[model samples]
Each structure stands twice: as structure tokens, then as C-alpha cells.
Target chain A: MRKTAEQTAEQTPGHDAPRPVRATQMVLRDTPLPPGARWRRFAVKLVALALIWGVLTEFRLDALYFGVPAILLGAALVFVMPVAPGWRISPAGAVNFALWFAVQSVRGAVDVAQRAFSPAMPLRPGFRSYAPDLPGGAPRVMFLNTITLLPGTLSAEVAGDEVIVHMLDTRADLEADLGALEARIAALFGLNVKSRGST
Target chain B: MPDLITFISAALIAAGAVFFIAGTVGLLRFPDTYCRLHALTKADGLGLALIALGIALTASSFGEVFRIALIWFFVAVASATGGHLIATHARRVDRAEGKEGS
Candidate 1:
């Protein structure tokens, strides 16, 4: 599998086709921004900036003098950057993902701690490659990034469609975990990703 | 209520400290670099997160609480990314050396 991946990487020459790139660029460069969407982005960014300023200044009324222009400058930064089409976020899905992530993070930490503190060290560390079903772009990048934080799994590299993951225990059903995470992330982005069968 | 909050905060902070110690133990005792990375990333990330949560509970203002939460989030991201980079480099070196898992 590594040889095949390296061969494909060579064929691509200038780029590794499936490797994840900055998703922000995809958001802005995918298509020309619509006027209404552009205005909405500006408004949202302005509100977020204002809220940040409010927090930093601890709601000082006098600080509004400097805060307003600072907000404008922050919004201008967003405007100058690439804005991807369909930037709408699913708030409900996001909340669910956050809850799930928190739970998993805690579980992962506990599991590792248990292994670390055990008298008889029980670890079968190994590397495996998985072909991600998520389409190339932000979703893939998100998947790769999210996997690293999960329990017992670390993504070594994302070459083309295959992500090489290092596992603390080879016995664990990592592909299933990856599938569940993929589905949750896809729901957050409102993207439809086909589920791959667990190995 | 103040007493209860203080107790909870102390307990959480102590628990976080325990995790940090466990991570350090694993770093010293684990057989390989990859195993150590697992220990460092997961345990340290959770330790910092628990500490942040404990601190946020006693925060004087909503903004201060949010700041604590933001710090935890950043820590989580940084630890994960940092761990991945180290693990990748280690794996590459292992492969170059024709060690196991190559």
C-alpha cells in the first residue's frame, strides 16, 4: 500500500492529489461570492469581532471609540480573505459534535492513562493505512485533524486518499471509529458522505 | 456555595495533575516513541482541559470563563497537531532505518 501511494504521489509530480489543503482557500476560491452571501459574511464577521472586543475590554462603554474601528479592521481582514460558498454551519450538528468530541476526548485520555499506569504494559503499537471516503478538501482535512485527537490513533500522513494512522493497539476497531467520526463531521458541514463498511 | 465551588475546583485541578503525572510516567517508561506520543497527547490534552474547566468555574465574569475555554480549545488543537508531527517524523525515521512496521 505504501509503495502504491508513493507511486501515485510520483505520478502527480507537482502535487499529491488527495493530500489535504487549507480548507479556507476552498471556501473563497470555489466560486465567485454572491452579493447577499458576501454581505452576510461581513455582518457575521463584524458581530463576532464586536463581541470579541467587548470581551477583551470587559464591556467598557468608553472603549467603543477604539472598538468600532478595530471591529471594522477585523471584518476587513475577513473580506480580503477567500470566502467559500455555502459557509452556512449547522448549529445543531455543531453542538452535537462538540458534545461527542468532549466525551471521546475524556474517554481517550482515561484509556491511555490506564495503559500507562498498568504494571504489565499492554500496548501493541502498529501502523495502518486507510482510504478515506470523504471527498478531497475541507472535509478530508477536518477528518485528518480530528483523528489525531481521538483515542489510540494518530494520523501519520495523508497521501492522496489514504491516511496512514499509527495505532496504540492494533486490535482496536479503528476504521469503525473513523467512520463514526466522518459521519458526525459530515453532518456538521451538511455534506453527504457515503459510509464505508467496517473491516 | 463558595466552599462547594472551591472544593470542586480543587478536586478537578488535582485530577488534572494526576493525569499530567501519568503522562510523564508513560513518557519515561513507554518502550517506543509512538507509544510515548500517545501518552503525551491524550493525557496532557485532557489534563489542560480539566484544569481550564476548574479555573473557569471560579472565573469572576462570563468573559473570563470564555477566555479559559478558548485557551483549552487552543491547547487541544496544538497538542494534537504537535503530536501528529512528531509521530510522523518518528515513523519516517523508523522506516528509513528498516525497523519494525516499515
Candidate 2:
């Protein structure tokens, strides 16, 4: 199965094609950003950093003496940083994803706590490799990070499009859960990803 | 109203503390690295989040509340990234040593 994945990756070098890299050799290759897009990203990052500064300093005018330079430096660093392919966030989808994430975090914590307190310690831990449908970028990274917060799953390794997930219970329907999570992330990014079990 | 808010905050904070205890216990009791990572990430993530929310409720101003939330956000991201890094390292070491899943 791993060999087949590598062969396919070698054959395809498209934007959505997964790179044939080992888990340890996972490096984010930067995609060239247009001048207009670069400036837009800088503007967005500057505003975000300024808002963070305002919250941290309680909107104090005197704090701007330090905050102004820090914000500019932080925003300026974006230009030198590798610019990966970006995704557009949908406001409605973000609200939905946030609500779902909150519920899942509580459920995941409660599930672990119950097993920890139980005398039997009913844990059937193992690893499962999943082929994610979301393209390799912010959407895929979000899916991996979010998996750790979901009940009974932690993403361990990523090889190409395959993510190895450590699960507390192997018997759980992980495929469905991963598919749903991927769908939620795709929605959040306004990307139309194919649902699982579909061609 | 302030008194009621205080009572609720205290309750939420106490509940958060319970999860922290459970997380610690799981860390000590779980069989191996991966399982323990699950316990650490999930329990502590929720624990800190609950504590942050509780504290935010009592914050003096909106800025204070946002600051508390920002702390929670940063911690959550850090913990998740840290957990994944540790898990990856352990997996690599296990493979190099010719051991199967932990």
C-alpha cells in the first residue's frame, strides 16, 4: 500500500498531488504568492497583530511606543516567511466549526477522564492510517491538529496524503469521523472536498 | 449578580481542576507514550479552556477577557503541536529500535 502511494505521487506533480516524502522529511515547500496577494496578506496580518496588541495592552496609547514597532516587525516578517497556498475562511463555516470543536473537546476530555478513573481502564489503543481528501495546506494541517482534539484520536505522522492516527479504541468508526472532520474543515475553508467513499 | 457570577466562576474553575487531576492520573497510569499523549492533550486542553472561560467571566474589562482567551488559544495550539512532536519522535525511535506500536 505504501509503495503504491509513492508510485502514484511520483507520477503526479499537480497542485493537489501529494509529494512523495517520508514522514521525517516532511518539509513545506513554498508556493509563490502574487504581489497583490502578498500585500493583502500583510494588511490582514498587520490588523490582526494590532488587535492582539490592543487586547494585550488594554488599548493604552502609551503602550504603542513598544507595540507599534513590534506589530510592524511581526507583520513585516510575513514577507520573508514562506508563503504556502492560502485558503479563504467562510464566516458562517467558521462559527459552525468553532461550535463543533468546542463540543468535541469536551467529549474528548470526558472520554479520557472516564477511562482514567475506571478500574478496568478499558483502552484499545492502536494506530490507523487515513487518506485525507483535503489538499495539502492549511486545510490539511487544520484537520491534523483538530484530530488531536477529537475523541479517541491523535495524529502521529504524516507521509504524503496519509496521516497515521493513534486511537484510544480501534473499534470506533474512525473513517466516518475523519471524513466528517475533513468535511467540516473543507467547509470552514470554503473548499469543496469530495466526501469519503466517493470517487 | 456579582456574587452569583463569582459562585459560577468558582464552580467552573473547580470543575476544570478536576479534569487537570484526571489528566495527571492518566499520565501516570496510561500504558505508553501515544496513549499518554491522548490524555495530556485532551484533558489538559479542556481543563485550561474551562479555567480560562471561568476566569474570563470575572475579568474586569472586555480587554481582560480577550487577553485570557488569547492565552487559552496560544496554550491550546502549543499543547497540540507539542503533543504531535513528541508522538512523532517516539514513533521514529520505536521504528529505529525495531519495536512495533507502543
Candidate 3:
């Protein structure tokens, strides 16, 4: 179904996740993307891609194989990306912390895998919500999904900025994770994140 | 043929990213809820398709690359189906809450 752009955005929530807030005045930020900021984000994306391509080049000696695609891709993105409008890039601090979240997800996933195969599985299952500190949609989505990848918690529901998560264990271990999680999300989202030990 | 493949793949990926950025912008710039939703899905579908092709082009071994390309296709289909369902439900919720006009 070739729906129009207007048709796609106005549609419903994508998953079983909580419905997005209706477009209220509160959700709209006055600080729209400035021209300079847009340029900077484009620059960052370009540099990152170039660096990745450099790595690819080191691995593959066939310049004729990769150069054409990389150059064309670079040129297309250079012109196309800066103008599209949505590229909301977090600052360096936030980006750094977001990477940390990815690492945390891997750790949580490993712990989960270990427990899943263990003889005496230390499992606890429950649901809880926490206030979100991050602003934009991507970070919040990334945050929730990454947390779900963690061993014990799957983000079952998100209401406004409050995410209701399901976890196997809600004890001291979970408590410790929440604190670190809170700090990490707070660092990334800039929202006032709070937790009463997962409840 | 290789040149054509690379050129087309890169073009698609770049275009996809552009759409994604556009969607993100639309989500912010659009006046109401439904309008923003439209922005998101359009970007999501096209952008993903483009990126998957681009990645497929970068792979060394044909078999491994082809496998990953299949994964990308599956992921695209899954997310697209999901976005459609969500959009429908969202519209219903909006209408019920008198948010349809907005």
C-alpha cells in the first residue's frame, strides 16, 4: 500500500508498546533544528561513515570494488541528509552514554543467557514504571528497547515518558541495575528519571 | 555490473537515510499526532530498504552476504507490517478521543 507521507505518520502505535502521546503543545519543542546544527549532524554522520569505509578498505584491497559505491553514497548523503529535517543528534555526552547503553544491553543479555541455562535459575518476574529523562523519540525508543535486551526486563508498556517494564527479579540486583540505568538514561535523555527499586 | 550495483545500492542507502531524517523532522515539525505518525512510517520503510541493500553490497562472501540480505528483508517486512497495524490502532484511538480532526 503506497500510503502518502501524511498517511504514515498519523497512523497508530507500531507495536504492543504504549501509544504515543497525542500531539499536545507540551510535546512540541520550541528548539527546532537550527541550520548550523543540521550541518553539524550531517558532518558527523559523514565522518562516521567515512571512517567505517576506511576500515573496509583496509580489509579489502579491491578499490574498484568498493570505491564507486562508497563515493556515490557519500555524495548522495552529503546533499540529501542535511536538508531532510529530522536528524536530531544528541550531543557528544549523550552519544557516549547511548553507546554505554548498548554495552549494558550486551551485559544484561549475557547474564540472562547464563541464567536461562543454569541449574538453579534465579528468576523473578514483575512489572514496574520509571519516569524518563530523555527528550526526543529515538533516544527513548533506543533506551526502552536496549533495556528489554537486558536479561531480566522487557519494556512491556510506555505511557507518556513513563515506561512500564517486566522483569524476572525485582530484588537488590535489579535495584542496583535500576540505579545505574537511571543515571545512564538521565545522562542521555536529560529527563528527570526516578526509580523506587523497579516499582 | 559491479559499478551499477554499487552506484544503485549507495543511492538507495543515502536516500533511505534522507527519508529517515525527514521523518524525524516531520515528527517534530508537524502540528499534530497523526501527521507526525505519517512522517515516521514513510521514513522507516524506504530508509530500511535502502540501508539493507547498501550493507549487502559491502559483504565479501556471496553466501554470507546473501544470508544477511535475507535477514534485512525479513526485518523490513516485519517492521512494516507492525507500523501498519500500529497506525491503524492509533487512528482509532485518536478518533475515539476526538483526536481525529487534529
TM-score of each: 0.80, 0.89, 0.44
- Model 2 alpha-carbon drift over 4 Å, by segment: A1-31
Model 1 over residues B1-102: C-alpha lDDT tens digits?
999999999999999999999899889888988788888888888898888888988989998998887788778878877877787667656655667753
lDDT of 2 by residue, A23-53 (tens): 3234355455566887888899999999999
| Candidate closer to the true structure by lDDT (higher is better), 1 or 2 | 2
**Residue pairs in collision within model 2:** none
Q: How do these models rank on TM-score, best leading?
A: 2, 1, 3
lDDT of each: 0.79, 0.86, 0.54
Question: Please, what are the lDDT tens digits per residue for candidate 3 over residues A1-199?
Answer: 7977666565633422335443222245425666676567656766766555555455465763776567557745755542332433347657878587546544553454344334565555455666655554455555555555454555554556666555556663654565576566655545555545544
Worst 10 residues of 3 chain B by lDDT: B33-42
What tier of docking accuracy does candidate 1 attain?
medium
DockQ of each: 0.52, 0.48, 0.03
Error of 3 at A153 (Å): 1.3
User: Best candidate per lDDT, number?
Assistant: 2
